[model samples]
Target: MTIRILLDTDIGPDCDDVGAVAVLHALEKLGEVRIAGMTHCTSSQWGAGCLDALNRFYGRGDIPIGTLTMPGFLDGDSGYAKYNKGITLGYPNRYQTEPAPDAVETMRKVLAEGEDGETVIVAIGPLINVMNLLESEGDLYSPLNGMQLVSAKVSMLIAMGGHFPAGKEWNFEMHPASAAYVVAKWPTPIVFSGFEIGAPIHTGRSLTADLPDTHPLRKAYEWYVGEGETRHSWDLTAVLYAARGHHPFWELESGTATVDAQTGANDWKHNPNGNHAYLKAITSPSLVAEVLDNLMTR
Candidate 1:
């Protein structure tokens, strides 16, 4: 059976999300997984359009797209237009003009359609969207509240955030309140691809060489890091592990993780009843980089 994945992303901040989406589409093409839905958690208005363009590029244009619509969520523009204007302009997508549905509503609708304990949520961004979903009440999409719907539908949450034993990271720091709330209140087992796990793995050099300039993925990389330059595969590793469970490439360390809502720092304790775990690299970073690069280039 193909694994169903609901991807929550903050695509405008970094180019790695582009690679992550490319990796996901490659896995889908291989019949290993299916996209359940996509939710954009950033304040950027261009995120949904960028995501739609990517989906269309990968030949999965029908995938549902949603965006955060909370007032004053990030107050100012999330700078998505500045970061992803190239993508939205270069690609053909209707989301550029017609906005996507609310993130929580889209999340609820997608979770409602999944079998109990089946959908895997791959969050390669901030936890704001997931936190809002957890705090949301029942709506037209489903009678179950956020917590109930997640408990009934989602199998696991694979997030790319935080630093190991104790430190800060971008995804966690961007909105620490949501990170803390989700970590404390979420119903399913939580797994993190922390900063240390993906920092050593550099990719995108091959992506520029392998894919044509017309490819949106290639263009995203070019826009972010210049032609043929590499970036750390933070989001790519999370998606890889989310799509393909366990392997020698990485191992899981079970522990309870806590986020300091104010500082956005994270700490882990080896609790006996801990429901969280983080990825630890076992295979060489070079080998893992090769694997990810191959997939992103596919």
Candidate 2:
């Protein structure tokens, strides 16, 4: 019953993506997940390196990471890379170099290496990689093209961007065309961790009180948004559901989620034929916070 996960994230700017990675590793440690690979849609040179440090901190430095090296593809620096240097000062790692294999190929390679219908794609970033994955043709990994390959291997899509019922968010805003395209034609069932879903579940405050100063997550959070402030838990919610799937936590709402191509706004419509669903708040934010902090702290 081990779940294979291909995580796609825009990690540096927001510390939640870091938190999402933490939870992924924690669950992996518990034998609930096997991280297949990580793909970064962010354009920062330091972004991939930061994730490498975290994975290494959790004893999984060998995990494959994909990066978007092309210019203007939501490229920029995440100030949180400042804390990553701390991890490298004491450990050896290969994340500092420019990312290789490119994101699309890296994902294809990850999927190709996995068993059919076992890999789950969890995206907590922009839709850049999703668009590319679907539009891409067959490569050295498999004879199947992008959509076909995904339909064959990946079980579902769990994304962490968008405000339900027609509102714009950062991930969708960055690439509306891609967002719209992905929601409309992606082959598997999709579930969203909406803005409202995780908006109330504040985190980071607990780490400040419980974790040691040497802890990388504590340091990452401290450097990213100061010592006391708590941020919303949007990305973390997606990671939880991706592994647990509304189990002891959430109630699932069935429907199709749509994005406006021009504005990146989203709306949900019920269709038995639709392969989409969005999270409906079930368990309280406090319970979610407790579960997330417990996993992240471990």
CA RMSD, predictions in order: 1.5, 2.0
| Model 1 C-alpha lDDT per residue in residues 1-298, reported as the tens digit of each score | 7999999998877899999999999999898999989999976767888999999988889999999986555426644444477888779886777878888889999999889998999999989999999988988878899999999999999999999877999999989999999999999999999999889999999876788889899888888888889999999998999888769798788989999998789999986578999988888899988888888888
Error of 2 at 124 (Å): 0.1
The candidate maximizing lDDT is: 1
Query: After TM-score superposition, what is the CA distance of residue 72 in candidate 1 from its true location, in Å?
Result: 5.2
Index of the highest-TM-score prediction: 1
- Assess candidate 1 and give its TM-score to the true structure: 0.96
Error of 2 at 132 (Å): 0.5
How many steric clashes between backbone atoms does each model show? 0, 1
What TM-score, to 2 decimals, does candidate 2 have?
0.94
**Model 2: residues with Cα > 4 Å off, grouped in runs:** 76-92
Q: How many backbone clashes does candidate 1 have?
A: 0
